[model samples]
Target chain A: MSDTMTNTQATGGDGAEAPRGVENLPMVKALNAGLRQAMLDDPRVLMMGEDIGRLGGVFRVTEGLQPEFGTDRVLDTPLAESGIIGTAIGLAMHGFRPVCEIQFDGFIYPGFDQITSQLAKLTNRHEGQLSMPLVIRVPYGGHIGAVEHHQESPEAYFAHTPGLRAVSPSTPNDAYWMIQEAIASNDPVMFFEPKSRYWPKGEVDFSSSAVPLHASRVVRTGTDVTLVGHGAMVTVLLQAAELAAAEGTSVEVVDLRSLSPVDYGPVVESVRKTGRAVVAQEASGFASIGSEIAATITERAFYSLEAPVLRVSGFDTPFPPAKLEGLFLPDADRILEAVDRSLAY
Target chain B: MQFLSTDGVFSVSEQSEQYAPYLERLTEADHRRFYRDMSVVRAFDVESANLQRQGQLALWVPSFGQEAAQVGSAHAARPQDHLFPSYREHAVGFVRGIDLLNVLRLLRGVTHGGWDPKDPTNGNFHLYTLVIGSQTLHATGYALGQKLDGRTNTGNHETDEATMVYFGDGATSQGDVSEALVFASSYQTPQVFFLQNNHWAISVPVTTQSRTPLHRRGDGFGVPNVQVDGNDVLASFAVTAKHLDDARSGQGPQLIEALTYRIGAHTTSDDPTKYRTQEELDSWVAKDPIARFEAYLRSQNAPQSFFDDVDAEAKDFASDIRCRTLALETPDMSLMFDHVYSEPHPLLEEQKAWLAQYENSMNGGESA
Candidate 1:
């Protein structure tokens, strides 16, 4: 094995007997580990963003990468979002796996034209002559009381584009595995990191692999109602499931890992078994990822569903200030309220 | 701006003198070949615009007055160097060994893009980026890749390769263009930014695009930049060749603002008369690059038979392109979903089947 692979394997902090035995790590550190492993496995892997090198990113997800791999691989780009993505597209065309960070969700719009017009369409436009093996990492969602643009959830816009794959990981373990999987895939992946969960610790096993990047997973199973969500909202759904269980009402929580080609198979199965569902997200309810989940569940599990598919999402208003964000975001209370309504029906 | 004078006089500035060796290295045969290339592509340009007017092509972006800027720089680039062009770089595409009809396939609305950029026979020329100023960043990124692979800065002129991207004056105003300049400067990527200041950007004049010279904008981004008489093919060739050499030898990025004029409308859809005046247009017409070069070749005792042979070849080439464009066939409808992902996408497969079924329904039956 190469030195980087050995380094990651040794650094995971778990003894060899438990192949899946993991180390307790935050989402950011897990992402860092994933990026480190990916770079070690493939010399072609590159990380580019503002403040990614010395600053290790605003979130520090790419921390220590420059020192470990050298600045050539972990590039510190100028403050230009369009340039970052456009150049990354070029690098991808020239056979480099570029993982670009938009830093925050709100700042991604400037580079949106490049991502949608060039990165997304390059492969299809070139008639398969080119493959864009690129990953655009954006820290999205709200909970830590950040201001506007910083807390926006723009996955719906990217998921709507046919040529892009949008995926989000709610836990550190998934973050570790999915980031590596995204780098390995030939398609361009829009990786949404749940910033609220960046500091949350979880057992991240580097020794073994996780599920495929695009597949949805039922994190916690119940029979009364299916609470479907992804990214940060998955935590809220899990908490709501717990709260509902105490009330003698069972709730199944499904983390929709990949938003674009949402693994509707598991979603449909969960909804059919539970006979009720509620999709939760921090983004506004109008034409959101939650809407797609609700629509898909209704179509695939129409006869099996006892109540209409409901959604517990943020109000259809602009992302408010830090003080009002808590009121705007979907939490366990709102999720429980939606579950109660679904159960009452 | 007039190095090779409009009156067939060849004068060299100190800057042009640095590149004079490149010009001296060229033989009578090379000059004739350059003249032939310019003449042939111009004929092809005129024929393309005519086809658009005659309702053959959906739209045509004419390179009427900007042939010299493209042909000269394209000739200067090494075979291993990657080239990125905006839509109107017809001459560059031709020099890159692309079957020019492939470009027509795109303009004719029969294909998404014409040729595979990675195809070696296509001269390492990338597919044309229709979006203004975007290709500059891609070129810079490709140059960065070259640097990472140790493909450049080897101190060996022949083995060291660089990248070149072409854009118009108006594209310089774009955020992506400025960003590309910033990244190229920061990374010291081996690349050249070839901006053709073709006096008019559709209806907008170059004056409105930048207050200072476009090359000066590169100075603020830390890239060494120069302005050339874009109409003088020799200046374009010499300057581009030198700067490309500098970039290949680890001199970082260089910018060349080629001062030229667009003799035709931006596209067949444009009305240039509304924005530009007849006096300005007539003045630029006198400094036509191909005409001036033809005059210089004649002054150098070029034979009449050579010019006659080039003219004949240009006519035949134009006719050949017209025939190929007319004979172009639409690809299978299934091709739409073919390259959406390298791996099969279930949703795309379902949509492809739906479209096929929808088309079959129009034919009064569904396939088994």
Candidate 2:
């Protein structure tokens, strides 16, 4: 289920050497490998979460880590989300890079106060005398047919915070590299893992990442309309781009890697070329990452437009039951329909 | 739970009898130091409240009644140990060698926190946590780090490290406090939860916050718990010394419920008269920690000159803080942006530049 191999690439100057072969692994396994590699590299790296130890997490993303790192390094904390995050802040103050796992996106609210009030502010509160080099790994978004709390996209909450870094990886390779990069960062990061795409396999090279974790990548280039997506929605956007291409729309796809401090440069550049864009996500269409991207594109590329910037997102309703998830989720059809509306202009 | 009777008599309880040796070990110098620290903070506390009333500070959290609880436990900690203080532990910070004026910097709205724990002069005393119960988790986490760093469980008291976190009764109701206890006990972290049960969380009473005594709350979490007469400085010192020694020597976490009272209001903005009875305030005043310690010191043959010197010194110290506070300068506006993150962040940089440009444009002139 998991494999670790060297990344065959030139060494990065700051000692980020992929220094062998890419491991084709699922997103969960790739994340595990990245965490394991980080722990192996830095003594300060530690993992804490509920059921993360003997149970290896509800998602098993931290599987086999407890045994490999020993219980001291891989702590199975008491069932307290606020405690996990609050204590992780304290541990970070004590100079440990703690990666905390929230069992589900909904369960994160219990720890939300710590994340927003304390973890987000400690570094600034101390005037840089301290740094919260912590990563909160949250398995988010829908399509797994799980209950109310399990499937959510709460990136907006973290992204809106001034001091915290929020990022989500849409693929296995990005998960492997980004988790490691987030842990190595000297600031707190909300690493939202798209639970629906955890099993999707990709070539995760251990060699090193080509760009900084914050940079957005153009997964598929096109000309007529640009389709912006992140996390699980990026996969759907790719499908929409392919569909639009066959219809002679030639839609470009941009995977927004970092939601906060968003790499709007590439998105802006793509939109300037395409003249139109549609941002998509599973979150409801109210003050969401989709709304933010649309706003940023509008601000940066307001004149370079064929039509008004549009959004294809989940309706403003509580994430519906498993039976209605397909309708609730932003799929290729909804995205291409948005593409049609944009192309119609 | 009481080492000295409230009537100014030195009498030890059975539970506190175990700490009798630590009391005996306290030299005249230790006693004088405790007196000096307590008096200094008390004077400073009074002056700070006056400053708040005079519009010099935005607010003040008075440590008027729980001096013994803070100072005793603070003195119990070794220099190597880390301390996490809830917002009102001025006496504790004083014992930890922090300049009392640094606390005013926060209440005066001059800085979020005026001192850094990493700076040696601040004495490893963490910045005060205004949010209740949050510091306990931080202390537990830091203690866990200490244990992992092999700084604890070494038989040597001087070498082995432990941590102490202070909070009030109101904070006990928070989920974070309970969670911190669970983690501390589960991880066997070398730590102390020094709860100054001051009987009020603002206008709310301790009775409303707890069904049983607060000390027993930690018992369910596997932490050894004790309650001491927080007004009795000797009891606080002895009990804390023993528990901290035990924790550092691998005894894991301990909870000390220091039974005290908030003689003053919660803050300068609070009116104790509105919520509490005059009779209750009078009763707590009668059990004042400083008065009780001063009486005990007199009974131990302390000279009048020594008492006069301490009182004079406390007054001088308070006056110095007042002078320094009045002379306090506002930090650079750029500080707000300087350390939002350890490394340079593009967003913060942009914000900083925007702020600078906005300030530069204040005179309604275009950029050169």
Candidate 3:
């Protein structure tokens, strides 16, 4: 229907034009493009997970990848998370870098044992003698009007492990670059892609000025207060900052690119400058990444605080209905309310 | 090396010649070392069980009577070969050069995994896998990697490599095991599927897990399979060596089922006395692998000091394990965000910040 061959560059200045290689495509299309590039770059690269082939993935994130790569490379596996990851580990050991999909955040539990116990420790147990060199792609977080087990933020579980690397991307540009970067790492990486942002289009640069997957990026700049978020929440944070700007409050937004081995330098520097910060995410407030960052700021930059660090997070309950998700998710109003509260303090 | 037959007389298989040449290589001194390693590993197993009983561990899977099966096969593997072990392979970990303390740390709930597997010097031993039959798939995959890397049957004894994966009768029932077998058979992956048919899976017995002999499951998957006396260290060693060598030579995947018994509770949380009788326990105890090996060693006129030295070594190793386990420090609570991904994530930053504030507020504005 569209000119698939025309890699038309998107308009310049705001960086909204189609990328040099992928012109005017949706997030899912860009993902498929990245997968194709990765497969061509490395022969060891293979894709396997549930409904990834033939069915084209639940979200069609892997649409057309199977036909191009063939069934041997892009495998549609049986309905077993443990089997998917367990086999991926075997494939990795045999010199194949498997990019496994866990289908959804809630469905990753069955394979949790394999990922945390076997895949995470295979390299460390051999005392650095072996490297898993595999990538696990999980579509996580809530915001889609979906039912139970479909929307969950379980990044904390994997982040707690010692040997695995965890990361998530919010934009099409970061998604394209990060997926390829994750596959090239010697360590095992758990790549969490926000399902809600899968269709959102953004400009991606394939010319490799793209930051490393583990580094943080400052998406929006401000001075009065810092708004920190990631994955789907990054987009929300940027929008919230824009809304705050109309009300004359400057907001600095930090898009933490990596979950584990976090680049706290950018976050701490921003907090030290702003003296006021509001952390927002869709995951529950109990024992979450928000808790870790809040504590680190207090410890590392206690004197810089003009007020206590404020957090606007989802309720400490199961992810609610799509109708309630708007209220449940931290929107511009909730973020601005926290910012106002922090300013008042 | 045979000390007993099915009829209870000293006998060796006609295939013994293949291993007999290596028997003389294991002099009295070497036998003493192997015995010492087994004794220490068994002591570690007992102490781990005690720790679990005392609530120092979340759970403990004892490898009491199955030590010979583990140690014999582990010792038979070359340094270059890799090992993938199920959770119960405590003795195999010891033989593969893992410190006894690391095993204790895992059972004590201090860490999910106790070691790194990538370091060739870690003796190519992987962390203990808790999922029943999953490691079989990993082993097969690793074996395939070895084949592709030109590491198998390189015609150089010092450089050629193979892989061994250990599981139990219960794991044989898992779909992953059968799938791994099929893949290994088709690819001719240089791997040995070492199944320790230890007679029980928690409360379920061997009969409940499989309709026929567990080894036969491999045959249906197209992997050549064999059965061995798991209680006989010499037999286990001979059989595993043959299979491993065959795999290394690119002859394809092989499955060896070691018929053994779980001489203790399935774990500290279990009480077998409810389902099995003391009579069954007594029967397996009489066929204790260590005792059988000891008898054969004595008949060979092995020195009395060898047994004395092994007992002393076991006590010392047990003391070290206890000391190290008791001294382990609780992990930093903030380490909760350390390994989720190799890259930075904005959401995690927000969550970490929120947690810090929550904890500090709960702690009366003091840093937590």
For residues A1-345, could you state the per-residue lDDT of candidate 2 as single tens digits?
012323443332367554556778999998987888788767899999999988898889999989877998999998899999988887888889999999999899999889998988888889888888999999999999998888888889999998999999999988987888888889899999999899878888666553578889999988899989899999999988888778787888999999877988889999999999999989998998888889878988989998999999999999898889888888899998888888888
The superposed Cα distance between candidate 3 and the true structure at residue B248, in angstroms, equals: 6.6
lDDT of candidate 1 over A112-203, digit per residue (tens): 89999999999988999899999999999898787678999999999999889999999998898888888888999999999999998999
RMSD of each: 2.8, 3.2, 8.0
Pick by DockQ: which candidate is best?
1
What CAPRI class is candidate 2?
A: medium
TM-score of chain A of each: 0.94, 0.94, 0.92
lDDT (tens digit, per residue) of candidate 3 on B245-358: 889998999999998899988888899988888898898998888787777777777789878988888988888877878789887654455444333445556777889888
What is the C-alpha lDDT profile of model 3 across A164-244, one tens digit per residue? 888888888778777877888878889999988998778775654447778887888899998888899998898888998
True contacts kept of each: 0.80, 0.76, 0.38
Model 1 chain B is weakest, by summed lDDT over 10 consecutive residues, at B1-10
Model 2 agreement with the true structure over B1-368: per-residue lDDT tens digits: 88887766887667777898888868998988888889988999999999999999999999999999998888888889899999999999888888889999999988998798999988899999888888899999999999988988878888899999999999999999999998999989999999999999999999999999999997799999999999988889989999999999999999999999999889998988888899999999999988888888889899999999999998999899999999988889888988877776787888888878887788575662
lDDT of 2 at B360: 78
User: Could you give me the TM-score of model 2 versus the true structure?
Assistant: 0.96
Q: Rank order by DockQ, top first?
A: 1, 2, 3
Order of candidate numbers by TM-score, starting with the best: 2, 1, 3
- Cα deviation of B4 in candidate 2 (Å)? 1.5
Residue A173 CA error for candidate 2 (Å)? 1.0
